[model samples]
Target: MSPRVKGAVLGLSAAALFGLSAPVAKLLLPSSTPLVLASLLYLGGGLGLAGLEALRRLRGSGASGREARLGRKDVPLLLGVILCGGVLGPVLMLVGLQRLSGVTSSLLLNLEGPFTILLALLVFGEHLGRAGALAAGFVMAGTAVLGFQEGELHGDVLGVLSIAGACLAWAVDNNLTQRLSLKDPLALVRTKALGSGVCTLVLAWLTGQPFPAAQVLGGALVLGFASYGLSIVLDAYALRLLGAAREAAYFATAPFVGALVAVPLLGERLRPLDLLAGALMAAGVVLLLRERHGHMHTHAALEHEHLHVHDAHHPHAHPPGTDPTEPHSHPHRHEPVTHEHPHVSDLHHRHKH
Candidate 1:
């Protein structure tokens, strides 16, 4: 399949899985404090992915040499991802969820897309076209409408700020993860989940948060495995293929999914403003999805390793006895070339517009 198609599928799938998290988490909240629940959620995702990794290794299906492995140089970025995404993001989200309706909280999550895109463009050297800029504006406008209702903000102001803060933290995490997208995604996410999970778990214990009941714990773990674990792996792959800004555009759909699910699951009413916000955000995502960018660009010669098939980008000849029919990774060189094709800000296509 085409890289863009695969990236869109991955991003959408990630959205569906993660979209269920907010409402379900709200239902689980009554039984556990935000800190303790956040810890369990991360621990669940980490442990679940770890088991899958172990199973893959046992079955000899591991990508031992088929994908690039993270190295010392990736440590700082990985740490940033864990700190922002796994720890700060989840904690703040849960705290906000406590004081807000599930649907509103879900809709409010639309902010993450704009925040991520802004970071991608301004700080991470990614580019955005006219459609992308308009899409961002629409999304921000939707958030503003939801944020200020009936001539004032809805729900608790503190809760709104907390969720926005979570979005910002995850925005930073998204960009950092994009930088590390060249590594084995499963391995990268596993390390991130486990590391952040442990840190949050420690913080929960220190704060005297009680452990949840067995049933609640189990539910949380399962949810985390699907939402945080698998969803994250898919998102990492999308980032590699589509760049952070485009991936965020697709992922922005997640909040709408969550909002819709919340109406039935949480018995929440969809106020007119909620519907209005949803319409605006949905329009923005549609624009982003329809947008395309392609131009004549140059690729600098470089050496790197990542899972790849010998295609337009990698026309280099391999050594004798190398497996030629499957995607594999090793240190390789790219001879400089200039060409024109439709592309986003992927690793190879980061040239200035």
Candidate 2:
């Protein structure tokens, strides 16, 4: 399959899995405060991914899990993504959930799409064509649709602000994560999970949050594995294959996933606004699927370490008998070349338009 197609699928899958976490977590809230549960969720994700990494080594698979191991130079940026996305985002989101209903919180999380796209366009220099712009508009419109009746006149002001703040933090995290997208995604996932999980778990203790019951701990771990660990690994792949804006656009459907599931879980009545927002979010995703970015670009000679195969883009020589078709990692240099072809803002295609 095309890289973009694979990327979109991964992004959508991640978003869908994340949608399930909110309501299930709400069910577990009686066991502990939002802070402690948030910490446990992250801890679960970290430990789960770490175990997966261990299993990969034990089975001696392609080791794609370690294909693009983290390096010295990657430490600071990796930490940044962990702190912004893994630590701050989930904590603030749970805080908002404290005040808002589970379904409402899930729907409100739609804001992350537009926030991610806007940051991608303005800060990361990602190109946004007509389709992308329309998608962004629909997503932005959806964000407002839920707000009109969120808490009636009084409004859940603190809850909304907290969730919005978390969205912004994740938006920044998504853009920054582009820098590491080309690395081993599983490695990245485990690292972020461990880093954020450990940090938040410690913070929970320091802040005097008590440990939750076993069932609640289990829920947090399970949710964290699916929502944070696996979801984020997929997200990293999407960022690598598709540009941030398009991935964000596709991911906008996450709210719909949550809303649909919550109808039964939360016994949520289908509101008119819910239908309207779902339509808009769906339209946005469809438009993004049609997006295509291709143009003549130059590749400046550079060396980097990441898993790569001998595609037209990889014009470097390797030692005798090395299979070019098999993906491998090395500090290969790209000779300057100019050509026209379809591409996203992937590792080799981060050129200014």
Candidate 3:
């Protein structure tokens, strides 16, 4: 399959894995302390990915330079991202999970998408046109309905606040990661896992949390590897192939998936209103994906047409100055004839048919 298709599949799979974490974690909570669970989960994810990177390095004889190295210049931003996304984000989420009901937590978690989109627009100058605005509205409205239906409005304000903070931190991480040029995806994930995991473990110890049992530790390890390590790698790949906006659209489906999974796993009941809201959310996602695919198709077609016409007209140019690989020059310009002269003099050319 094409890279784009592979990316979308990976992204959707990551969403599915993330969706499973909520309910599975709810089960594991009874058997394990939250801080210990959080520490082990993150540590496992970090170590698992690090191991994979080490194996790759050994097999390739250290020739794979795609791994990103953390430089002093990247220290501050990296620390901030890890502090917010890696350390604070999961801790808040785990705390919220312990206090809030599964359904309530899932609904509240939907806040991440809008927070991300708003941050992208305001901070990164990422455009969200009329269609994107409509998509955002649908998602927000659906989430609000779900939240109200779940009786999250009656829950502890502090718990809600904690989850909200987690969402915001994730939003910041998503945008900030986009700014850095990390050649090695594995290295980036490893760095985030190690930094965030270590910080969380330190904080947990400082807070006087008890150590986990062997079974609890084992569960946490599995959870961390799947939810943190693999899911993030898939998410990064998806973002790289599909761009942030489109990947965010796909990622928005996770809450709904979580809600669905909760029914069997957590014994959560869905009301009629919940079903309606879910349908609306699904519709919004479908519309956004279709719109993105259409846009990509048109862009690729335009580029193909332009290149085809340029090549047909400049068939005999030398490999250097007038090479077809170079951009076409202005047709109206007066210049002496040489191999370097404009071959396809159509700088302002428009492709037709």
Candidate 4:
């Protein structure tokens, strides 16, 4: 299938898994302190990814096929992403959770999509049509209604600001991740998990939060593995194919997914508001899926490393004995060309706005 379709699937998968993490985390909150729990969760993810990578290594796939490797230039971007998404954003959200109800916090978390879209369009030049805007409005309205806990900010200005700040930071992180999407998704997730995981653990220790029991820590790691490691890897791959704006639109459904999972796990009663939020999210995704944008655009001569099949955009020849039918990665060159096709502003489609 095309990259756009692939991206949507990956994005949805990522959202679903990430949504699962919340209620499960709630179950574990009593077992550990905030920073310590967050650290363990990410530690599990990082270590899990590392093990997966080790398994892949045992398969003897060198650093030359179907994935790009990180270079010296990627350190800053990787570090920035780790700081924003892994550390600061989660910390802020955890703080907000302390002040707000679970339902309220979940609803407010939907703001990340809008924040991401705003940054993507204004700063990153990702496209969004009129329908897209209305869809976003609908979803936001639904979340806003659900979040109406008597009044805005749940009567606490600082709490609202904290959640809003977390959303913005994550938005920035999402956009930044798109920048490095051409690299190996596994490596990307691993770096973010490890850096942020270790950093948060240090912070927790410094703050005198003692480590939890080994079983609790192990459970946190398992939670991290499924929810974060696998989920983030899928997200990275999706961002590579979908671009920041579209991916964020799809990922915005996480709150609804979380609510769905919470129904059984948390024994939370599903209300009309939950259904309403789901409906709104579904409408938004439908609009995005129906969007079709195509134009004749020029491609500058460029050199890059990414997994690509010998499609229209990738017309370069493969080496002897290599399969041209499948996607593979290598440093390659693209001579200037102009073509028209339905597309999102993905890595290769970063044309002029």
Best by lDDT: 1
Candidate 4, residues 120-172: lDDT per residue as tens digits? 88998777778767766666665665555443435267777788889999999
- Model 1 over residues 1-353: C-alpha lDDT tens digits? 77877898898789888878878898876767767776777778889999988887778673443688898989999989989987888778877888777666766766787899999999888998988789767766765565544433357998998899999999999999999998989888889888888988888787687897788889999988988889989999999998999888777667667777889999987788878878887787677777788888898897888888887889998899877756888778988989889887888877887
Candidate 2 — which residues are off by over 4 angstroms? 63-66, 87-111, 146-150, 153-164, 320-325
Better of 1 and 2 by lDDT: 1
* Candidate 3 global lDDT: 0.64
RMSD values for the candidates in order, in angstroms, are 3.3, 3.0, 9.5, 2.8
Write the residue-wise lDDT of candidate 2 on 1-353 in tens digits: 88878988898898898777767787767657766776777777788888887888889776374376788999989988878986788778867877877656655776787888888878787878786798768866765675455443323889888888889888888888887887888888788778877877777788788897777688789889988788878887898888788777766666567777888898887789878988887787777677788888898787788887778878788888764546887777778889998887666776786
lDDT of 2: 0.78
Which candidate do you rate higher for TM-score, 1 or 2?
2
Clashes per prediction? 0, 0, 1, 0
Candidate 1, number of clashes: 0
Residues forming the 10-long window of minimal summed lDDT in candidate 3: 296-305
Residue lDDT tens for model 3, 1-353: 65445655776787777767767877876665666666677777889898887788677633233333445766777778788877778788877877788777767877787887787667665555577568657766766676665344446888899889899998888766654423355666778878888888887888787776677678877888888788877777666555555456667666667778889888998888878778877777655544432121111111111112233333433345543424433122222222222111011211121
Quality of model 4 by C-alpha lDDT: 0.81
